[model samples]
Target: MKHPYSPGRVLCALHFTLTVFLLVRGRPKFLWFRPLSPEKLMDAIAQLGVCFLKLAQVLATRADFFPLEYLDKLKTIHDQVSPMNAEEYEKVFARAFPDPSCFSFFDSAPLASASIGQVHEARLQSGERVAVKLRRQGVDRLVEKDIRLLRGILWLAQPLFSRLTRNSLEAVISEFSDMIRRETDMLSECENLEQFRKRFVKSDVTLPEAYRELTSSDALVMSFIDGVRIDDKEAIGAMGIDGEKLISKLVVFYMEQMLIAGFFHADPHPGNLLVQKGGRLALLDFGMVKRLSNATRIAMIEVVKAANERDFELYILACKRLGVVAADAPDDKMTEFAERIFDIFGDARLSASSMRDIAFTTLASMRDLPFKIPQEVVYVMRVSSLIEGLGTTFVDNFNGVKDVLPVLKSNLTRALGAEAGLFPTIGQELAGLPLTMRRAKTVFNDLAEQNLHVKLSRETLDLLEGRIRNMMRPICQGGLFILAAFLVVGMELPWKNEIAVLLFAVGALRIVIGLK
Candidate 1:
């Protein structure tokens, strides 16, 4: 095991601790030594190194938690890093390939550098051009150390912020750790690339083909793609590509990925997407991807369907089913949340800013509520946010609802057809309608007749019986008091006096018991 007292780790821990302390103090201007701002906090995280940088990237997705300015600063956090020198690359390369002659040409300089690793352009002996990605020296150890530090921080702070720590904070860190671990494992990336490449064969999206024999857990080799960055509108225009059409296709591609394919590239930032000559999109970086379960996909479809139909109740139901809201959440709170969400979508054209504002407002409203975000749904939201952000950048006056509704409707139609055929589904429901109506009618009639009965569990029955006894106790005590007074006034016998006394004592006892 590496020593726990590394200088780098100690500096990172101190930097994080101090930055958090300042933020908690909430008096950035009061610092005598230096000016502090949200931007400075972002810089602190960036300087802490790759693990912290990755954390900042995840934090940027949470518009609900952080301010827009902070998010803006963190959003600029990229994978760009100082490239490793030739000697370092050669040493790492030798671990993956025992002999150095497997490649005809290998560039000493890196094509791109990220926090965990760097990619270099290379050509195999067979003359195939490929991108060789190698993990940074000792990145695994660094990440493990950083994660330990972060976990310790979370453990220490959990008691102070119980509400935030109830689930989200720990969950976010755990998910990030899992994601980063997978990302560092190049074999996983190779698998993702191959899967996406196979999945998008019928679509216009291009994925670099992975060379399995040349790939290892520490290194990966894939077909190198040469294309302009998708975000470079001028370059795309120069190539005579229709910008609007390209954006539309991109949106459709993601919609299919989420709704139909049930798997999607979770990260689609401008840097990771490239455009080939025919406007074909070449997707890079498969380290972070999301796969939706069938139930979740259906629930998402239901939400879209409800939104299109302007049915808030159905939308809320869909949310509940999707685990977006608690299963036992109060109807009023869910309705309020759903209405707020609807208000955001009620407008005809929904821009990325409007969506983000809605997210912020919704989160603010739900801050005091028992709303919980499921782990699976977090990735879904991240992917949706990225797609919306990309759309906003690529297209002017982008209407997310307008662009997404048609694809949703199409997918729904296809799903319906595949499940039971649309007409048969309708027929099945129609066939069951009379029995349902009959049952409803019978229940209404029973209620009108005052003969409606509810089945209760033994526990519930005991509770109801206890409540009835309590209600009767008050009336019984009052009756006993009156009886005792009558016996004291109207009867002259010694026995009558004793009976009145006993009656008074019983009433007093009843009162005492009720109080208890």
Candidate 2:
């Protein structure tokens, strides 16, 4: 079906096309003209309205997909847009409520405005204070038109940027469009609030209660939360709140959300988080949230475990499992890529700035490597990076790696129960058991026949050591078992067989030690 064209759609297309052109041009050809900067690109996207602004916000989280300069500029794109006039707001509110007197008191001026909606402070007929969030009139039609125009542009440009298209650009846009459409539906935001409230019922974090009776697809009402902005450290201190402790609590809360609950607030920018009295955290804005599937969760845990252990090879493996890297990627290339990642993050304390640097460098280098983060996990990465950013603002010398481990460990224990204690190490060994046994059997048969004269070159030993260093705990355990079995089967003499028995005992001891 053919769609009608609008000025908003035309303007968005023109702006996006020009931005892409300028970005691709890189440098100015004319002597008098200066090259377009990242800031200019950000401004252009912001001008495209809420959808593009939200897109820029999502892009900002992808440290691994974009350059640091672009990321830095994109992160500053605020949701606060021009507010609708009182007359326009009244029309929108009337459409949703159909009763001007539904609220005893309604502010003519919006408390805050964003691309999709504007919020106002109001009092219910029952005298309760609430925030009324109303979608901008005709925003849905505009968004739909713009998205259709965007898809058409992408279709036309698919051949020019086949690589990007191959990377699932269309899929990403579709997901983003779906998300924004949901955002336009205030009911979805209310549901998000309820889910978060339920999830955090026992935690120190607080969420505004949704007024379902007053909510609809276009309008939402929730109990207003009174708190200081979380990033306003001076304000928090003036209120006698320990900013550092609150920051720590914030970190732990997010950790529990992501690692334990597998659900999290996707947009945790400073404005969305507020510090209430007694240093309690008040979370607001549930327009964007993400839920991680079990497989994705496991992949993230594996990546963290590998990074914590400094196992570059295992890190590569985890990335492969996460579909960030192709399964058939050359081992040497994967190793090199992993080495580069470790070099970036290995010694650096885990802070927002450091992570941004790592993501920028790693992604920049990926032009030559086979790497692509899955769309499903993009929000996860974004939320993680956001946490780091918030942490740096809240605490000095904040080490995310140090802080995240205990939370991860505790959540993993709860998730895995008693068996959770044996992880990648034992898991790896069991997975490789059959292959290890086969290799050991061949060695034992050769040795028993007196046909085996083992000789090791320094280079070969070095390679073996490298493999051992990169091996998972389970693989190491299996290697010991293999060695002990080979010794027992290969030895003919009583004394030598006794030594083999001792080796077997030692291997058993190693397994027990690993368990302990």
Candidate 3:
């Protein structure tokens, strides 16, 4: 029998040659190949078009997924990107804005470029310094074409790539595409910038003020910040101040954003952060920001609190919350990891050097077991690691554990201490936590009862509605996935589109009904 869609003769020949060459170059036992050097890989990616560029982007934020060495390497290209053609920029600008004469402050050469697009430093009619970010010309078409090509390539390469083996390649590509698509749309970036602006409206944390009139789906104009990148040591010392103090404030500001405000600057590496007078940490690039769901928030706070207090049980659950360990992780593995955590903190109590080693060792071990680090922790850990790296480079004798110990101790005590109101509050939050078992119970209980039904109190309908909203989050998440799959399989077969769309409808119904 003949199978269609087989590799062509030339491709087969090339693949065989590459495989043989890799086998000679790499470990025979693992069958691991020596991948292309980073520079060659980056060059290959650029040649592959914007989709591969987007893939590189998703890889950039996934610091937790990679080992320390790989993470260190990724940092080098965190913002370094080859600029797009200048003539293409003119077309994008012209399409986005009818008249180039209107934005006379435009510069042809880009100040910086990235997977999403490039930024050009420009001035406004009001004589204010601003950065104009322009979307690449024909980006939407490119995205559509590249995504189609990417799906084909992923489908083709699934057998060879180890990372894509255990996980769903379709899911990974979907996440990557969704992220880049959102990035491509300047409207979304504006929304993100506005969302971030609202988070720090009156704080020391400064966000760019977006100029709506000068913005469109393809271009964005916003206030330009002038300050040294937080990573640059000489610049900070040149300003005549304590680098450690500035770094400390940065740690606190970002922590407050994630813990208190729930809107975090997801890409808070030193490059994305700038330092100015009075220890102001200017936050740039809101493209990768993440908002913690209330349940996730409470869960994260509990997890960190547990680590600070050495509560093994809470620690296990926290690992579960972060998706580092399965909810059903073997008790021995759980105990081992828990003990490891205690030892790490115990050493951390003695010195900062110990704390860093402990965290790295623990993370490395987790990699051997290899579980998915939840998206929130993935982003948080990257930001946290960047902070740690910046501290090492810019601050003197920096100890994150020591600096954060007081606040952490306070929070942990507040969470676990037997004080009157504190215990009750902790209990309430604990009870309210989103356990998978609870969701299963709700679903099956309704199914066992042989009909979907709801009981509502007339007097507290508003409160009842809000309570349901809290319960329906999982359903909403399911809806997004269903819609994505529907978009994929629609053209494949008859009724498939309808079926996929129906799945989406059911998901939405679940959410709306749950909220009710």
TM-score of each: 0.73, 0.72, 0.67
424-492 per-residue lDDT for model 2 (tens digits): 657867889999999999999999998887886322453464455444565478568759767677767
lDDT of 1: 0.73
CA lDDT scores, all candidates in order: 0.73, 0.71, 0.63
- Winning model by lDDT: 1
Ranking by lDDT: 1, 2, 3
**Consecutive 10-residue window with the lowest summed lDDT within model 1:** 25-34
User: Residue-wise lDDT of candidate 3 within 137-226, one digit each (tens)?
Assistant: 776766776676566655665555443122423545665566667777888788899987876786787778998877888888889997
Ranking by TM-score: 1, 2, 3
What would you estimate as the lDDT of candidate 2? 0.71
Give the Å error, residue 446, model 2. 42
Candidate 1, superposed: residue stretches over 4 Å from native:
1-36, 163-165, 345-366, 396-399, 415-516
Return model 2's CA RMSD, one decimal: 18.0
Give the per-residue lDDT digits (tens) of candidate 1, residues 425-483: 78988999999999999999999999999876322443465566667777688677857
